[model samples]
Structures are given as structure tokens and as C-alpha cells.
Target: MLSWPDELTTELRHDLFGWCELWSVPTLADEVTVAVSRRLTSSLGRANYRHQRVTLQHTLLHPMAAALLREVLCHELAHLAAYRLHGTKIRPHGREWKALLIAAQYPPNVTYAAESLPACFAVHKRFRRPPARRSSWARLTQWIAGIPCAVR
Candidate 1:
């Protein structure tokens, strides 16, 4: 886990404000916190917290190239922007995310290259159900072990 540089945070905040301006929405408060942690075992990053309340968390465990970080930041910021504008009606990673992604200057269809981690791997499947809440920890452990995990 690595802390985002101050300059990078400033740039992202500035770009977010610019996006708000473009959409005619109020500028978001500058209180959002970006945290990186090794605890995350899913994808490269995740955005947590919304509803114009607290600092958003962006957790990145494995190494992310600079380009990947850009996408992740924009992707997370889009969630913040979407919640501010459309509340809970907006689908995550759907149209709203895509629009805000582009507005934040990432390519609309940006795809991160699979990061190489000797200790990590991915599962590929369709119709995989969400893990039962009670078994989440076990599931996560399985994932961390490089197993191809699916909830169901």
C-alpha cells in the first residue's frame, strides 16, 4: 500500500471541481480522504463512502501502474459525483460512472491491464452469486490464496 502524493491529490480534486463546473453542480467539499491498504484482495482499487458525507476510501493492495491509478481515481471520483447529483438512483459503473469517468478525463472504455502479483490471481465466471455475508472472510482468504473463487 502506498499513499497518494499530495500533488496527485490536488490535481484530482481540481479536475473534480472542473467536472462539477461542467455539469453545473456544486463543488464537492475537499474533505474526501483517499486511503490505500493491503487488506483489499479484489481488484486494484475500490471507492467507499458516498452521499456527500465523508472522505472516500480508495484502497489499492497490489502495485498499480500510474495509468491504472488514473483510471481508479477517476472511477472513484465518478461515484462521488454521481451520488451528489443523482443520489442512489444511479447505477454504479453504469452510465453515470461512464459519463463521470470521461468528464474526469479518463477514456470512456479504459481497461486496466491485469497486474502481476505472485501471490494473487483472478476468477472468471458468469452467474456467480454474491458470497453470503457470514462466509465473506473465508471467501476472501480463499481469494488471497490464489484460488479461483466464486460465491456460489
Candidate 2:
């Protein structure tokens, strides 16, 4: 089972507020519920219910630290922003998610590291061109596979 480090949680809260400032969305408290469950199959994190809540699976928290926390937070918050802006009408990782990610200062491509975890979990070193459309679950499955952790 995975659990968030105290420092990581603190930083995640700060960054979420920062994202709110950038996107012009209302600021949310660190009250975002994060759980590290073994049931998840993707290295990716999820923000469900229109940013009202979020969950970071245990495998997703492999190497914890400040930078890694920020990357994870941004990645999950990107999902929240996408859901909030487009709702169920838009694809989860489509254009809106990519735009919000870049706007939040992360590379457009969903990145993961192979060796020791990256300073930023999902921020790839290589720059990737933004996709034209929302990513389907199939694409997300592929993306998640690229992460070094085992997806249960």
C-alpha cells in the first residue's frame, strides 16, 4: 500500500492553489483526498468528479520527494482542470488537459522515468507536441504502461 509523505502533501496543496491562480479557477484547499490503492493499473493519477476529489494510487507514489510530488500534483490537477472545464463531454486526456498541463509549465507529453523516479514524476525531459484531440482510454493505457512501476 502507498501513502503520501507529509512534505509532498504540503507541496501538492500549494501547487494546486497555484494552478487555480493560473487557470482562473477558484482555489481549493489541500482537502483533496489522496489514497494509495493497489487496485489501480496505471502509473497515472486520477481526478474524479470534476476536481471535487482526486486519488493517487500507491504504485504511483514510488519515489517520493518535493519535485516528484509537484509533478504528480500537476498531473492529477491537470485532470481536475480538464474535468472542470469540459465535464463528461471531453476526453479525459484530450486537448484541454494538454493545454492546461503546458499552461501549468509541464511538457505536453505525459512522461515517466525508468531509473530512480524523476524529480517530476510525469514531466518528461523531451518536449512533445501537443495532441490535437482528447486521448482515449486505449491511449491512456499505453501512456500509463510507460511508467516504471508495476500497475496492478
Best by TM-score: 2
Tens digit per residue, CA lDDT, model 1, 1-152: 22344535556556555765765554553544555544544543445544333122122212333444555555555666666777756555557666876666665553322233211123333212326563444443433334232111
Least lDDT summed over 10 consecutive residues: which range in candidate 1? 112-121
**Each model's C-alpha lDDT?**
0.46, 0.52
Residue-level lDDT of model 2, residues 21-127, one tens digit each, is 78666543343455544454343455655335555545344442335446666766666666666775665556787798789887757433322221223322222
**Could you tell me how far off, in angstroms, the CA of residue 110 lies in candidate 2 after the best superposition?**
3.0
Give model 1 RMSD, 1 decimal: 10.2
Total clashes for model 1: 0
Judge candidate 2 at residue 78 and give its lDDT.
Answer: 65
Distance from true position, residue 62, model 2, in Å?
5.2
List of clashing residue pairs for candidate 2: 36-58, 94-134
